[model samples]
Every structure is written in C-alpha cells, then in structure tokens.
Target: MPRIPRTKSKTGLYHVMIRGNEKKNIFRDSEDKDRFLEILYYKRQNGEFTLLAFCLMDNHVHLAIGEGTNDIAKVMKKITVSYVYYFNKKYKRVGHLFQDRFKSQVIESDSYLLSLIRYIHYNPIKSGLVNTVGEYRWSSYNSYITEKSNFPNLIDKQIIFMMLSNDPQKAKQLFIDYMSKETQENFMDLTAEENVIDEKAARLLYMNMLEEKKYKFIDPIPLNILQEVVSQLQAVTGLSIRQIAFITGINKNKVSRILRKHSKLQGD
Candidate 1:
C-alpha cells in the first residue's frame, strides 16, 4: 500500500522524531550527542529553522521546531545528513545512520503542545536513562527552567514559560515543579495503537488540531488542484516545492505559481 502523503504546515511547528537505523544506537558517547547539538545550532544560525525543544536519547531524538526561512524537512535533512557524514567518518562505518524517514506530528492544540513539551522533557526518565529529567544533561529541560543562553535557538522558552505562568520566573519554577519527582505524572507515555493505520489516523487527528486555523495552500489555487500540482512536481523532481525554493532562493509563492502553470499546460 502507498503511504499517505505528509501534511505540511505553513508556520512549521512540528514535533519531530528521528530514530537510529534498525533501532540501532545513534549516539555512541557524549561526543556524538554534542556533535548533533552543534549541528542543530549551526542550522539554527543559518536560519533554517528554530528548535523549540529537544531531547537527545541514545537511540533516538525528539525536537519541536518552528519553520524559519526554510521548511522543517529541509532543516532536518541538513542536520541529519551532516551528522551522518561525520558519524560515518569518525567510526569508519556507514550504511544509514538514521531510519529512512523521520516521524513528525504537528502540534495543534495548546493542551497537546504543553503535553509535548512535558513529554519531551520526561523522555530520559521514562527510558530509565536518568531518574530525573533534570539529570539528563543533553535535553533542553534545564535550559528551559534556568533561562540559560546555551541553546538560544534550540528552544522557544517564552512560549512554554508564558503557558506555565504569567510571570516568567514563576513559570520557570512551575515547569521545574512539574518535572520534579513530587509531581508523579508520567508525560512520556505513548498511546496504544494496533497497527500503522491506527497510528497514522492518530497522527493526522493530532496534526489537524494543531493546525486549527485554515491555511489556504500558499498559492491562492483551489485545494484539489494545488495538491495535484504538488503531486506531479514531487513525482518528477523528487523534491518538495518548499525544499526547491529554499535551495534555489526562489519565492515559495513563485514556485507554487510555476507548478500550477506547468500543471495547467500539461492538462491542455
């Protein structure tokens, strides 16, 4: 069966997960994790995307990202591709460093958004990698609580803090309390799903909620027609319009117009 197409977000806020190939280890040591973070920082500086929150586990990684000048897919590709290259070189072994495709879930609701932040922060604890979230040095949990500037672009602390408390300091403290042992809440739990269909349905439902505001395709074209154009373009070029525009420095609107025109010409 063909896979369902990925639904893109205009504003680019996505909860992304990249796991090791075949459930293998992505990080051999602290150096590997640090290298990944460094690549993330470099991508942010290049204005590819903004990292809202992130957690680096031994076998997988989680990130909440807001699209910046580039789409999330491209941004992630650059980060992962570069890291894989370095990883292969350092270890003198290679095939695929990460799973074929990273998993992404759009965050649609304020409640789910908050839950995601908590979920990501609590990953290490849930995995038994650490007894407390704060004990995990690779995650953004402490940075979110302390207002530290180490990861300027990795997390949008303002949003989380604002949600937690009206006062930033109070919010930080509240977030800390939530992650503390006293809370007894398990945020990292995954939902039960019988199969891929069930999981995809759940993901779509979650993504739709995250995108509550109606966004017409970046082009003013009708929805069905626009999708057809996107399909044709992807089939021929193996590139998303967003990715093409980012690489070529063309306006996304122009790319959409070109694709629409090309589609019309073909039909004629």
Candidate 2:
C-alpha cells in the first residue's frame, strides 16, 4: 500500500523521532553518540530547521525543530543519511542504520509546544540514563539555562523563553519550573507515558468504562473523563484508530483526535 502523507505543520515546527532500524542500539557508546550529535550540529548549521530541543538515546533520538530554509523531510533525510553513512563506515557495517522514515507530530499550539519540549527533555530520565535533568550532558536542556550556550548554533532557546515571560530571568525560572522533576508530576508521569499496551486488557478497560458511563457516540462526552480514558487506553495498548473506534463506537476521527490531544506517549 502507498504511504499516507504526513500532516503538515502550520507552525513549521515538530516533535520528531528517529529510531534505530529493527530496534537496534543506535548509540553503542559515548563516542557514537558524540559523533551523531556532531553531524546533527553540522546539519543544523545547513539551515533546514531550527533546533529547539533534543535527546539522544540508546536506540532513538527526539528532536524539536522549526522549519527553516528547508522542509522537514529534507532536513531529516540530510541528517539521517549522513549519520547512517558515518555509522556504517565506522562499524564496518552496511545498509540502514536508522529507521526508514523519521516520525513526527506537529507542534502547533503553544501549550502543546511547551509540553512537547518538557517531554523531549525528560527522555533521559525516563530511560534511566540519568537521575536528574542536569546529569544528562547530551540533551539541549543546559543550553537553555546557561548564559553562553554550549551549542551556539544547535538550539533555539529564545522562542521558548519568550513564550514563558517578558523578563529573561523570569522566563528562565519558569523554564526551570517546567523542566524540574517535581513539576512534571503535576501533569504526566515520565514512565506512565512509556506504558506498553496489553490489547486484551485494554479492550476490557475501555468496555468497562464505557458501560459504566453508558457513553454513546452521539452523547456529549465529558471532555475531562474522555481525555483520561483515551490516555489510559493509549498507555495500555498500541491500538490503531480503527481498532479503538471499533471498540468504543466513537468513530475513527474522534479516536484519532483524542490520541493527538494527549500525545505524550513513549519517548523516541
């Protein structure tokens, strides 16, 4: 079957994910990780996108970017192909290193944009790579805090700080609050986002709640409870839109919308 076209971002910004091909480790050690970042930095300088945030993992990477002189596809292709070439040459390996295509979710609204930033930065903590946000040296989190950025051309921190407040210091402090572990607990748990779905169990949970509420597709849904249900259902399983619609009688569009709204799933 032909691939469905990706949803375009009006804001030209996205939360992008690039995983290792076949669930393999992309970064075998600190040296590999460093090399990947170096290539990423060079590509960032090429002006396809503005880097906002990033997290390098054992088998994947998360990048927050705003479209610049080039589109997302070109930006990612340039980055991924180069890295793969380097990886292959160094390891004495050939063929795909990263996945066939990088995955992305548009970062449109300011609220979702901020949430996505926290989500990306929180990746290391979620993966047990580090105990604190500061401990993770590979992420762009520190570039936002320090006066002189470690990655001068690699990250765009001004936009985020501007979103936080008019005052620079106050904005930094707000970002500090937002990135802090204590603050993350107020909304979503980092690990909870990593929940793997059990399909049999998930179908039961959805049915039980629907039956209890006697919810019908035509009936007005309580947005709060509906969001909660969608989140729980997603956490427990990786059900497709059609599968979810089949169970809830809510239709594919509604299921897709709900999942998109609470899109804080597992990290890259």
Candidate 3:
C-alpha cells in the first residue's frame, strides 16, 4: 500500500517525535546528548528552523519545531543523517539509528500548541526521571523559565511567551501555571501506546512449565524440555544465547545448540 501524506501545519508548527529502532537507548550518556545538541544547533543554522521546545529521552526524542526556510522533512533528514553518522562512529555500529517515518501531529490551534509545549517539557517528569519538571536536565524546560540555558544551544521562547501576554512577568507566571497544571498525555503513556511487546507466548509457556514443578525451565532440563524452554524464552524475551546461558547456568555452546535446533525446526 502507498504511504499516506503527512498533515501540513497551517501555522507552520508541528509536534514531532523520533525514536530509536526497537526502543534501544539513543542517548547512552551526557556526552551523547551534548553531541546531539551540537548537531541540532549546527543544523538549525543550516535549515533555519525555529526550535520551540525539545526533550531528549533515553530511547527517543520529542521536538516542537516551527516551519522555517526548510521543509520539516528535509530538516529532520539532515539531523538524523548527521547524528546517525556520529553515533555509529562513536559506538562502532551501523544501520538505521532512528525508526522509519518520524511521527508528527500538526499544531493548528492556540490551545493545542500551548498544551503540546507543556507535554514536551514534562516528558522527563512523566518518565519518572525526576519528581519535578525543574529537576530534569535534558529538556528545554529551564530555557523557558530562565534568561538563557547554560548550553550553547538556544530555544526560541519568545513566540510562546508573547502568545500568553504582552506583560513579560505576567506571561512568565502564566506559562509557569500552564506548564505545572495536571497533565494526561505523558512520555511514558505515549511511548507505551506505540511500543507493542510480544510476550503472550512466553507467558503461557512459562506458566505451563511452572505447573510441572519447573521453576524457570532450566537446571537439568531434559533434551525434550530444552528445546521448548529455549525456544519460548527466545521468542518471548529476545534474550541472547549468552544471556540464556547466564540465566540457566547452562554452557553457552549448549544453549546455542538448542537455539540453533529450534531455529532449524521452525525454518523447516
């Protein structure tokens, strides 16, 4: 089937998300985050896109960007390509870093725009990274409240603030209130909605083994049971042979042999 076209933002504003493939950790450390921010700042200059708000999570990212001289796709392409190169080179890995087709929701209304900004800023809090929004170090939350961020990268806060009120102090207070209000669409809930983990078979198989006095389908597992246990565990948990060996106290080569047999039978 053909792909559906992306919705255009009338106000030239879009709420965008890009995630790691298979929900893998994208920002492994503070250095990675800083490197990504540097890329964003450099790319922002090239693309001329206005960075409204952003939050960098461990496995994914949320960005609120205003339409600039370049199209959103092109801007994202530049960022993704450059960052993936840097990331792969640093980690000594390859292939796609981000999932295909970055998800986006158009910001058409004043209310939705305001709400979306708050949601993006509060992502770290929703993920339980910190109790309060002010405590999170990776989000643009501070830039909105403070004069300037400690980082070299900058956020365009004037547009959102000016929308609230002409009076600077009152606008700041209003923004604070709006940001701190009770929220429903948090980072955790949204990511969970998108991530569909396949654990049904694993759960059923584990339960059946437990019925037979097998604690975890390991330790003196007969040849008959070895295939079943290893197969189900691989399907359910996506564990590597080494991990299974560690968990089961079985030799790594033995675990590999069982896994190989299971794959061969399935292939046939």
Candidate 4:
C-alpha cells in the first residue's frame, strides 16, 4: 500500500517519535545516548528546529519540535541521518537503524502541547524504567524545572515557561504542579494500530483502572484482576494476546486462558 502523506502542520509544531528497526535497542549504552544528544544539540545550534522537549528511550525517542529554517521532514532527516552514520560507524553495523519513517502528530494548541510535554517526560515512568520523571536522566524534564540547566542551549524552555506565566519562578512552580498531577492524557506513538487502540493508550487505561481500584500497577495484581484487565484490553484494544501480555507483564498462555474464561462466561 502507498504511504499516506503527512499532514502539514500550520503551526509548525510537532510531536515526533522514531523507533529502532525491528523493535531493537537504539542506544546500547550511555555513550550512544549522549552522542545522540550531542547531534541533537548541534542541529539546534544550526537553526534546524526549536527543541521544546525530548525523551530518549532504549528502543525509541520522542521529540517536541518547532520548525526553524527547514521543515519537520528535513529536520528529522538531518538528525536521524547524522546519528545513523555515527551509530553504525561506532557499532560496526550497517543498514537502517530507525524503523521506516518517523511518526509525528501536529501540535497546534498550547494545552495539547503541555500534555505532550508531560507525556514525553513521563515516558520513563510509564515504561517502568524509573519511579518518577525526575529520576530519569535521558529526558528534558530537568531543563524545565532546574534552576541551572546543564545543557542550556539544548531545550527552548522560555517559550513553554512564558506560556505558563510571565514570572519565571511562578511558571516553574506551575510546571511542577502540572507534571506532578496524574493524568490520563494520550497522544500519537510508534506502536499504534489501525482502527484500534495504541500500546500507550492501552497501558494508560490499565493503569487508570488499577489506580481507581487502589491497586498499584507495579505490584503483583491478583489473578482475577489480571483476568479482568486482560478481557478489557482484548475487547477495547483489539490487540493480540502477546501484546496484552507484554503490556500487563502476564504470561501469554495465562492471558489466553483468562480470555477463554471471560468468553465462556459471556456466552452463558
């Protein structure tokens, strides 16, 4: 099938995601992640784009960018190409490192932009890599809240802060409050399924349900609760058993059995 053309953003602001090929780890170590950031900073200095926010994960990356001298596509090409060359050379590997084209959603409103930033910052926590956004070192969260920025030139925080308040201190406080609040915000991601829910959305639903029941999602949930979760996930997401298991950390065979029992009960 021919690929659909990306919708041009009138505001020139976008939330972009790039994943590693075959769901492989893009950054094998700290050096790779740092090098990717270095490339990003270089691009920023060159007037490529306004980097509002960024989160680097093991197999993927999320970026909130505003257009500069070039369009989003051109900017992504420059960044990804540069990094691919560096990565392949350093790792002694070849071929495409990134999976197909980078995925992106247009950011036209300030509210959605803030939500996107929070979502990006919370990626590490959502993936169980950390307990909180601040605990993660690979994202731009610190740049927004810290009194002194380690990479001052990397993130364009003034635009975001100004949106929050005229006073810098007040804006920082507001940002903290906004991020601290637990939300059910969802956005475009790499693992989206056509006509069905994405992985992130599914995970958010599970977490919300668990939270409402006063059950910590990170803890071992009861078998009955797992069954309910699996059934709901299957019905709402239309995702496979493996996908459900991956999302909930349940065994594939158990997820299937849970679904079977639910189906039998519904039929009766």
In order, the Cα lDDT scores of the candidates are 0.66, 0.72, 0.72, 0.82
Worst 10 residues of 1 by lDDT: 192-201
Candidate 2 deviant stretches above 4 angstroms: 147-152, 181-268
TM-score, ranked from best to worst: 4, 3, 2, 1
Off by over 4 Å in 4: 147-149, 193-268
Q: TM-scores of the models, in the given order?
A: 0.65, 0.68, 0.68, 0.72
> Tens-digit lDDT track for model 2 on 141-223?
88889856555557888898898789999988888876773323111122222212223355567756655777632234687
Residue pair clashes in candidate 1: 51-154, 108-209, 108-210
Error of 3 at 48 (Å): 2.1
Cα shift from native, residue 146, model 3 (Å) = 1.2
Candidate order, lDDT descending: 4, 3, 2, 1
Tens-place lDDT per residue, model 3, 1-268, is: 7776776777788778988988888889999998888888877776569898889999888888887888888888888888899999999998988877787766654545666677787787767889888788888888888866655246778888898889988888888877886555322234443422222344345446644656432123477676787677778788777555433434578778898898899899
Global lDDT of model 4: 0.82
Number of the top-ranking candidate, with TM-score as the measure: 4
Model 1 Cα lDDT, one tens digit per residue, 168-258: 7787776776555222222222331111221223333323432443422111344454445444444545666655443222346766777
What is the C-alpha lDDT profile of model 4 across 56-119, one tens digit per residue? 9999999999999999999999999999999999989989999999888777656557777888
Q: Pairs clashing in candidate 3?
A: none
The superposed Cα distance between candidate 4 and the true structure at residue 132, in angstroms, equals: 1.3
Better of 1 and 2 by TM-score: 2
